[model samples]
Target: MTGDHYFSAQPSTAIQRRDVEFTVAGRDYELTAAGGVFSASRLDPGTAVLLRKADLPPAGAAGPFLDLGCGYGPIACVLAAVAPRATVYAVDVNARARELAAENAARVGAGDRVRVVAPDEVPDEVSFAQLWSNPPIRIGKDELHVMLQRWLPRLAPDGVAWLVVAKHLGGDSLQRWLGDEGWRVERHASQKGYRVFRVTR
Candidate 1:
């Protein structure tokens, strides 16, 4: 198996640590990344696009938000920093990614607000007020759709989700699919060949 695939639940490669720094919504972040994680060397372009394009949570926004497929906790940390009253859940399948995300959260002093966990570890009763993701599109269309189906429903009735996908990676098709699935999907932004989608129930 390739060591570069972020969707590997247990990456079969040695962890070689590095630093990844980026700015989102005027806030700066320097997080730890490793060989086995997603965007192990830098802030992924899709993630940067998503952060820049989506409507971030208001400072007064409260309660839980979800960073689905959180790699090293970029989105989760941003949400926690922006919405101090909220709790951010950083969910990932890769163990190495989860570890790095937790460490990054602590580094940002949002450790108290960022909860890094495996997908199934999230409490069944907890529903999210907002969801953010730069999904693992390489997992193939079927698996990607399954992942979205599993979590998108957990959004509260008034909640919204922000997603970024590369235009060549079926971004438009995904938007249509979400609409067909009964979501109110909006093409919020298109930048650098990436499509940012805003989805609501």
Candidate 2:
């Protein structure tokens, strides 16, 4: 991976930690971000839309959940906060991102329940009840598809994945591809030029 890419295993960008504040499901979050992570300047708009539009697991929900490509663990933290019984896995390629995610999860009091790790650290035997992502579309189509292929099959038989992609960035095409791959894909919501897909096996 490119040294500057947020998908890089170890980002070379200068570390500059800062706080990004946002609200999801009426709860507030102030996550720590650094130079090499995704959306370090603010709560990414696509993620904002996903959390707003998608159905978060209820307070009583139990899960082995996933926040794929978790940058600084915003989604993972939120999932853990909302579903106290859930174990939320925050997976990322960037080591810096993983570190920040761990710190952020602890800040949100979800550290014990949120596992922040490298993508390869996830066990193959583990299956997810739900998955969420504001995918790194800029990573290029083939890489993005490969990433999805690696993770989507880990979903439990009845599990669902929530994804947010910019409309200009092949959201519809991705929906078609998922359908072609035999998954049921629903365009759950559209806002701020982003498309939210709810996918199931």
User: Model 1, 1-201: lDDT tens per residue?
Assistant: 445578788887788899999998888889899988888999999999999989998999986999999988888989998898889999999998999999999998889889999999999999999999999999999999999999999999899999999999999999999999999999999999999999999
- C-alpha positional error of residue 42 in candidate 2 after TM-score superposition, expressed in Å: 0.1
TM-scores, all models, native as reference = 0.97, 0.97
lDDT of 2 by residue, 1-201 (tens): 336988888888999989999988889999999998898989899999999999999899888999999998889999999999999999999999999999999999988999998888998799999999999999899989999998999999999999999999999999998898888999999999999999999
lDDT of 1: 0.92
Off by over 4 Å in 2: 1-3
**In model 2, what are the clashing residue pairs, if there are any?**
none
lDDT of 2 at 50: 96
Query: Global lDDT of each model?
Result: 0.92, 0.93
